[model samples]
Target: MTDVTSAPRELRKGANVAIRDLGGELGGLTVFLDSRGHDGETIDADVSVLLLDASGKVRSSADFVFYNQPIALNGAVHLRDKLVPEPDSDEAAAGWSSDVVTLELDDVPQEIERIVVAASLDASTARTFGDAAGVRLRLQRSSDAADLLVFDIDDATTESALVFGEFYRRDEDWKIRAVGRGYQAGLAALVTEHGVDVSEEADEPEGPEAPAVDETPDEAPAPPGDAEQAPAPPMPAEVDDDTGTSSPATPAKRSVSVRRPTRAPRLPVDWNASIPADDGNDWQAARLFPVAGIGSGEEQERRATSALLAVMSMVREFGAALTGRCGAPRGTITTYIEVPFGQDEEAYRPDGVIQVRRGTREWTALVEVKTSTGRLNVEQIEKYVEIARARGYDAVITISNELAGGDADHPVAVDRRKLRKVSLHHLSWDQIRAEAVLAARHRGVSDATQAKVLEEFIRYMSHARSGMGGLGDMGPSWVKLRDAVKSKTARASDKATGEISARFDELIQHLGHHMTGLLGVEVQSLAPREAPDHASRRQQLADSGLMFGRLKVPGAVDVLVVGADLRADKASAAITIGAPRGDTRPLTRVNWLLRQLPDEAKDSIRIEAHMAGPRAVSTAALLGKARQDPSCLVPEEQREIKAFTISLEVPLGNKRAAGTGTLIGSVKGATTTFYADVVQHLRPWVAKVGSPSRAE
Candidate 1:
């Protein structure tokens, strides 16, 4: 099936290849865009293709850059029949998702002379292609594995989009050229360059609007911006025969079409329905069952504090959409998570505080978080309400595991001119989770960091046993999961292995929980290093005999935990810091942090600088390197799951500690030391990272 003269070709910027040599056997050309951002992180990118005629006039185009749409707004009849832009494919590899355009050469019209393929970052992400790593373009035949052209972009740091290459007709022969041109203004600019009408779109409202239906001429102007200028087709003037007089025509009456605003869909389940009347403060009760010298009770309290702060942080970052999903007065909402109150820093401190500002005037919202299974007391509510009122707050919110007997309208606000009356309201953690899911799905969240935080927080709470709602019971609680698997009778063959793996998974979950409770920060489990090779990845994690985990705390260099070879009779604790993926300024931030730490503090911890090149490490290389140094931290192991191309590892506790029992205590002690180290070095770093960006 091969053509004698046809051959695959690789290309760089400004290079060209003859399409005639691509072969007559080629039925169609497939343009594949592989977006590798950091460490398999989600980077929403758009791939568009433009069809041009001989004179370079654009005849048709295809793209999926609009909200909720995965394909071009309009279809080109000359292109492939299947117009799905974000077509699902089984071949998508780890650390990379692909979008493809198929060109049916046989179906291409004779007038079509060229096709240009391009990639762009969505405006919502506020990122450019340069912000993304390892973006690649390839042209090849669908039937044949051979590639006609491959373009690996080395740098596009300031550009949002770039033309990877183009196919064109040169006299009787078809040829391909490596364009590699960038568009800093994103896809809009690129489309404009290809003759798209972007000016009309620019004039339209920046916010989302409902689709227009058949409407009267008078109402048409209120709809689309383009329709505002278009004059309705004129009607002929009416004449009265009896008087032989000409009269101006009256426009025909049109039907009035009115659509109500879309309402947010209710959560699938009433989150409050399953809440037990009494929880006996099980979160705290469970903490009483501590392993070794770790004060589980104190740890749980700290975790509760952290969880509260995390919630406030989400509310703070997402603002009205997150905290006021039920509704808030129209204005910018700002929140401070766990900030001290009163004139003194050591005075009364609340879990969270919010300020909704409308012009010069502002209303305050004070929040108290309770993660344990407990009911809000009338006295506590009254006290907090009194405190809020005294502090001039308009509202007081208490977050707990159970829903109080009241309507969904909790934390309702009544605005007054000078001072507003503070209202008391109780919110269940499940409610927060539900709102986050809703916001993520329908609110079109733009900040990648906020989105990631929301997602991770949800995952963290899903496993948390205290909350009430779908998140409370949809899956087995960690305790129930551990018990169910641990109680199963041992068997031979396949079933035995499954049981063992299930038990191991529980151990991993316990480790995550232990860390969350102890560290008072979000901690997540990671798949075993050998997970990819197994059909049942969960089982692989158990079989790997090494527990791996990640930490998520803003501004601090990412930290990781790897339990020393679990299969070994004895193990020690290890924490990796200065993880590079997701952290663009890893070196600068980490070095700055290290410098601030006292000499004695720095000398106590083992620090290794595993710096590489300026460019991000490829996923394959990272994985291989991980295998080479099991003790070394990699990007995939980081909280954001990015290529921590460079990092530092600090092993806690001495190798003298042995036995599984000692492992727990050793880890507990090491974790304590690690926290101290982080507080000394990383806390200040987080403060710097979280501060507002300064004017350059």
Candidate 2:
């Protein structure tokens, strides 16, 4: 609708003009939506573009009215034609702006004769243009960067949708028309008029009987107001129109839970090298930086930098592992390492980028890696945050070797006020390593060959934790520790044995810490209970069931205090998966306790059929008690059942010399293997069952 009469050229409400007059070389047009609250506050509204054929019938359209998934069609001629509705902001309502619809004129199909731009109040909020001080559409021409048209609405009334303007072809030329038409109904009604298949809230079942996931199409009986509208056909099922009947309902779709794939199948660690063996040997291969003593100044710097980058690479892999651990379906999250951004050589590069998607929902996270000694500055973090926000990343996580200042378990805060919608977190390398070990262990148990690379990576991390400094001096502590274990004689002084055994103490303590951190429990090492003499302490330890440690892990019904024993010299470690004895020892419900364990634990860990010793209670006796009185299962009467007493250990090396170095090496290797075994064994129990419950 254009007028060639003596009409004002300046665009205003209901103004009609020729687009050829606006710009001759216009290749593209960007339509922007602007609205201000009564108090001059910016308001967020949906802006859309619709293309129509010569007959005024809809050809192709992009709108934010349906589930916020605006259609975007890419064209070879002009690249892209799409709608950028909102900038994924947390304060989307308060500071809302940037809802745009871009149209490449060259990309528009020849059959399309007109382009219509419109706006509507965001469906989420119960507000209309009448509640705003101003609502307008601004058209910008791409060729000359000119503001071609501005159509402002004045009489919005109680209307929620409005057609601001249109660009139409007239007599082999393009013309603009400011068609200020408003609809009292909301966007759904407005979109329906232009042929958009949007499902209405009323179509959804209102009662609790509704299925958790509705795979079938909504086909409820139409209300009086919508009697003219036909019901949607059930998807993936044919509709029989012969007798006006629908086919048998499609089989109810089962909701599937997903687990994402790990990124690194091959690690940088060399696994052929043996663990420390004898008192005399070249321990260079075991050292992270063997050339620390031989390299020149520049060579040393280069090597150090290279080593740091290698560590960062591992950190990147660790982030990829973390993404997989979030339980998304395989291929749902893809990781890109060392992805560069910004203008040139001085560009910002994140160590890794994790792209996650499940159907239409998609998001991204940037990972920044740092060593324990490296500190993240405000300026650098600010820059990364800015870049992450600009690139539309949901989160920016920094994986570092540095522990959190306040709490080791909690993430450290990077000053993130400048990041409007981007979340920032600091995860310690220790935590990442732990998670990787556990995840790799689970994968390893299923298929050891496939998980070899990840297992090697875990081993490398464990070995590197032995104080390998920043490529300075090849630390003697680790070598000395290894050597000390190899040189110990059979009959050493009591003082010397206790002092050397402290290494074992540290190793076991570390295990306790790892277990405590993972299980959210208090794990304690149980030394020979206050024995009077060395002879008495050895006897006490022998009679203590050789149980060296206990874990008091909390559960729904009661606290599960489990004990485990693993001597560095022994080939097996025993874990008693049962509750500690108390006043209600005889009333334990063995069957219910067994049910609590996942199938993996039962299959992997050897389960004892019946309890032994006078203190031990049989599963048959517990079942009889349970049968005699169901009340026996109550909290007060029920004792913790030793569900099973099983040995969980793998051969590290043959019982070598009792020297400190050999002993330490033996414990370290065994502990590393056992960690994997335990994590893999307990995974099913700890993993989230399906998904969190939602209000129906």
Q: Which residues of candidate 2, in runs, are more than 4 Å off?
A: 1-10, 60-69, 75-96, 200-696
Q: How many pairs in model 2 have backbone atoms within 3 A of each other, for residues 3 or more apart or on separate chains, i.e. clashes?
A: 11
What would the TM-scores of all predictions be? 0.30, 0.31
> Once superposed on the true structure, which residue ranges of model 1 sit more than 4 Å away at CA?
1-8, 35-44, 54-98, 132-135, 198-487, 490-696
Q: Which consecutive 10 residues in model 1 have the weakest lDDT in total? A: 214-223
Kindly give the number of clashing pairs for every candidate: 3, 11
The deviation in Å at residue 693 for candidate 2 is 19
Candidate 1, residues 1-696, lDDT tens digits: the string is: 123244456676666666656542332466777676675464566666766654354543232222222233221211221112222332233346666665545445666667677776744345777766677777765433356667787867767667777776665566677666776666666665544444322212222222332121111011122211212324445677898665433222222112111211122233225445885665633321222242454354445546545554454434553444322333456666567665323366666776766445576777776654444555555555667777776777777654321112332232332123665555656456555554444343456766666665555565544232221110122233233334442222344344334333333434444444333232444433342323353343344433333433222345445343334432333344433233444333333434434443433344434445565443322223333343343233332322222222333222222222443344444543444443324321112123322100
Give candidates' CA RMSD values in order: 24.9, 19.1
> Residue 240 of candidate 2: its Cα lDDT?
66
Report residue 660 deviation for candidate 2 (angstroms): 30
